[model samples]
Target chain A: MSWLLDNFTLVTELALQHARLSAVPIVVGLLASISLGWLAHRVRAARLIVLTSFSLIFTVPSLALFVLLPLVLNTRVLDERNVIAAMSLYAIATMLRGAVDGFDHLSPGVTRSATALGYSPTGLFWKVQLPLAGPVLLANLRVVSASTVSLVSVGALIGKGGLGYLFTNGFQRNHPTEIVVGIVAVLLLALSFDVVLVLVGRAALPWIRNLGGTSPT
Target chain B: MIEFVGVTKTYDGGAPAVDNFSLRLAPRRITALVGSSGCGKTTLLRMINRMVDPTVGRVEIDGEDIAGRRPVGLRRGIGYVPQDSGLLPHRRVIDNISVVPLLNGATRAAARLRASELMAVVGLDPALAHRYPAQLSGGQRQRVAVARALAGNPNILLMDEPFGAVDPIVRADLQQETLRLQHELRKTIVLVTHDIDEAFLLGDEVVVLRPGAQVAQHGTPADILADPADSFVAAFIGSARGKRRLTISAQRSVDGADRVVVDAGGYPVGVIAAPEGRLPVADPTPRSRGAQVVG
Candidate 1:
């Protein structure tokens, strides 16, 4: 704790980097997941292929992936791109499942109603199907973001991770306080992102507030 | 001005869903298609808006073949009320009601105004406009669906089992509201239902269909009831249809009350005799609204 105060600037900077590193993968993964999910929903065989491939990709150990990504992408072992690339794979793996589940949870009769009402295909997809999918997608955002935050700490094993460096550094220098600070910081960051995602979801969809006023999470 | 001339539909080389169906529906009148499940009652209704196309014949609206019209354009002018209300659960009541008009190019303000007006017209309170469908009771949601269907002031309304989801009391209320709306608006309505009583009560003409979509009988309620075409029609009306077998005599009320008596299934049996032949109560069918009981 004393070392953390002594190097508060260092801690804050690394924490910011950690947040950025985690957030990038989540954003990239969300876009890719949405596209894949849409395709899977429309194509009969795409769901099977996507689910199987994503499951296999997710099973790659994080340490191995962090090391293996640099070789695959032709980057340096210490370059931050290596960590981001690996974390994005994890993020996409997580979010694809969430997106598929969200789509499945849609109200059954809404599609039939929209068609009978004469909604154009584009209009139905954007105005009705996508907006109605807000709750499920929001739930996915929280899960993917939190997991990404946790996994960002794992990158520190390679000396390129954000918060995980504090752990390795504190141990090398016999600074238990710094280690505690790093643990506390990562937990707090994950919690903050979860709350933020929830707030964003609520602001975008006010209709969800009246669903018994309970947490959809 | 809807005409179905020799319209037939079959799915995947199977038995015809609607076999050689032909009919003409006069403007501004309610025609009911009633039958058991798989009788193509729904298929017949769907053919109007081009949801299901005829395999062997063309359907015409106002002397124009609907096959030539774009489906989306044809559907926009025809209001549809599907079974189970089919309200969009994520949307508020007002947004659901206004969706059609908004899609049809009405400004948001104009659409919302029309939505509120329709809310009142469909017997829904204005306050419910901002509530999501999940927060509403089933009956309230059904009214919201009706409001949505009416938002565009459509010339034709296709109601597919519109009142099938509600309880008996709410069903009665909705039916009364529908009748009042029909009388006031005079829009052409095609109501599809399996309930024979609902068909008799609401339809200007009822078309009965068999399992294969063959027309069993087609006529007014009085026409079918007064003289059944065959035993199949008679049994379809009711198993204990004693009116065709027994003669009903008017007897004085035992309690000396001015009322008509009925047998078990609500058939009018006799009326209380007027004192000293002043005249028995004239009619048994309650002409007032919402007096509907099982036939």
Candidate 2:
């Protein structure tokens, strides 16, 4: 408690950085995944290849991939960009399959109706397909967000992971307080994001609020 | 004017679904294409908007070949109602009804206003417009589909068994609603159904198709009834099932009025009032909805 009080400014700074590190990757990764997922849905054989590639990337040891990305991108090992880019890649890997499933989750009957009613291809995607898939994607979003928050700590291994070096400092100094604080911070972040996601999802799909057998929850 | 000139559609070199079929759909009238399942009635209906293209024929609307037009543009001018209603589960009823108008550049407020009018035309309550499709009953959803189709104020409305999915009571209600709508809007309507009675009830002209889109006979309901083309036509219309043999011989109670027609065995087969030395003119007092009357 004394340590936190004494280092209040540092704690708040690190927490803010940690939140940014977690959130930016999620946003970037979701944008990338949405595009990639749509391509997978539109093109034959693209789904299998994209999903398989993302799965393979996910299987690679996080530290090894973290170490390897800097050399490939020609950036310094400890640069924040390295952590952000690597975390985004991880987020994309985790979310790509689920994103594709979100699109496939659209009802065939609805799609046929849209086409029959003179919805142009672009119009259908914007009005019907994307909004219809929003709820399912939101469920996947909460899961991916929690995972990203935890994974942001992995960047501390390379001296960039936010709130993660607290555990290291705890280990080195034989102090349990720092480790507990770190776990509490990450858990709090993840939980808050899950609630925000639910709220945003409800706003995005007002029709689903009263709909049953539609929401996964 | 919509004409199918020698239209033939085959699936991937397989046998023809609609083989060298041709017909003219009269303007602003209901023409029903009725047959059993797989008789290409649906395929023929879909060709109007180019949802299904005929392999070897030209479908023309107002002397313009439909194949030459952009499908989206072509379809926007034609209203379509499918068997299952196909209302988008995620959209509100008003949004579903306003889709066609929205696609055609109507402002949101304008589109919604038109949609409300269509809802009334289709016998749906304006209050239900804010509800999602899942919240409504099956019959209400079906009515919503009709409202949606009519929202564009389309010159032509194509219905592919629009009432097939609802209960018989709802089906009868929808049929009456359609009749009322036809009386007002008078749009060119092409209806597809397997139920012969439904075909005759609503169709100004009924084209009976056989397997492979063969036209067994095409005529008015009365023409088919008074003079069947063949045994196949007779069976298809259920004329051979003692339905045609029915004579206006007996009487039974109808709607608290003492005018109802009974069959040869004194059972109330229908209600018809034949004035002395005159043909039967069905007494046109609006009977209760869903009551079946035959002649």
Candidate 3:
């Protein structure tokens, strides 16, 4: 109890760090994925190839990805950037798949109608397609974000700062209280982020709630 | 006028969907392409807007070969309504209706205003402008789709089973809406449907396509009903003629002696003369009245 009081500020700082690390990757992955997914949808022949490649990337083990990042980026320097790069790679796979699924699931009639309406392909993507895909993409963001919170701990192995550092220090020092606190903090952070995403999804895309099973036509 | 000269479309390594199809569509008229599934009626319709390019021949719109124009540009001047209302679920009803005008470079505010006007034309309340597509009923969605198609005020409209997804009651309402729009807009419309009754009701000119995109018959509804080119057309249209004839005859009635025969409800249905005085049957054989009195 006395130790908890002594390290309260330190724990909070670690929690904040962990959150920032998770957030940066999720945002970057989401934006990149949406753009790439739209490009894949436009090019008819490339859809399967792009999806398959992303799926392959997702299959790679998370730890291995983190360990290998320093080599790929050509930096012996192991820091926050490496942590972000590894988590983002994992996030990209999930996000890309989500964006692709969202777009593909849209009614083909919408595309046909837009085309007939004289919408340039670009106009159609931004106005008709992306807005319709909003809810699904945001739901995907929640999943990827939660997973990212847990994965960032692996960055601690490279001496980066986050809750993972707390967990590592607890283990090295054999302090069960610190380990429990670190784990709890990560869970709370993930849960809070998820709730925020749901609220954002509802506010940004209210249509998803009313999208009943009966699709148009 | 729209003309298709020996248009043939063959999918890779597959049999031709449309083979040597040739026909002309008169301006400001409603022409229906009727056929069984896989008969390539849709393929032929797609050719007109260059959605599908013909493999063997040319499609001309207003006497100009459409081959030279970019497909995206060509599609802009043509309205297309699919079986599904195809409303973007996330977009408000007004935005969906404004798609064409927005695409054509109209400002957002102006496009929205036009959409509001079109909503009234399609019998939707102005209050519905802000509602998402998912919030509306099937009938309303279809009306919004029709409004969207009319956004650019195109010279031609293409419809493929536009009301096939709705309930019978809703389908009737939508059909009436289409007729009303056609009357007001006077745009050349090419509609494709497998339902013979729909073809008969909406088409100023009906072209019946047989298997492999063959044109079995092309004529006005009365002409085709009066004289079907072959057994295929006769069987197709003949089954519905009894009820159809009643509808036509009802329109021709001129007096108070003609009592409007309605169903259980008070809605004007058809005219039936008193049984005491009846026109003699041309044939002594029993004839079936194919006309069904739908409520």
Judging by TM-score against the true structure, name the best candidate.
2
What are the Cα lDDT values of the candidates?
0.83, 0.85, 0.81
In angstroms, the error of model 1 at B85 is: 1.3
- Clashing pairs for model 1 are A1-A177
Error of 3 at B72 (Å): 2.2
Error of 3 at B213 (Å): 2.1
DockQ for candidate 1, C-alpha atoms = 0.40
Task: Give candidate 1's whole-model lDDT.
Answer: 0.83
For residues B45-125, write the lDDT of model 2, one tens digit per residue. Answer: 989999889999999999989999999988998999998889887888999998999899999999989998888878787
Q: Decide which is better by lDDT, 1 or 3.
A: 1
DockQ by candidate, in order: 0.40, 0.40, 0.50
What is the docking quality class of candidate 3?
medium
TM-scores for all candidates?
0.90, 0.91, 0.85
- lDDT (Cα, tens digit) per residue for candidate 2, span A1-217: 8877886786677788899998998898888888999999888799889988989989888899888988989999888888898888889998888889889878887888789899999998988898888887777777789999999898898888788878887889998988888888888888887888889888888887767533211
Off by over 4 Å in 1: A71-74, A212-217, B243-251, B254-259, B264-295
Rank the models by lDDT, top first: 2, 1, 3
TM-score-superior candidate, 2 or 3: 2
DockQ of 2: 0.40
Please give the C-alpha DockQ score of model 3.
Answer: 0.50
Reference A-B contact fraction recovered by candidate 3 = 0.67
Give the CAPRI rating of model 1: acceptable
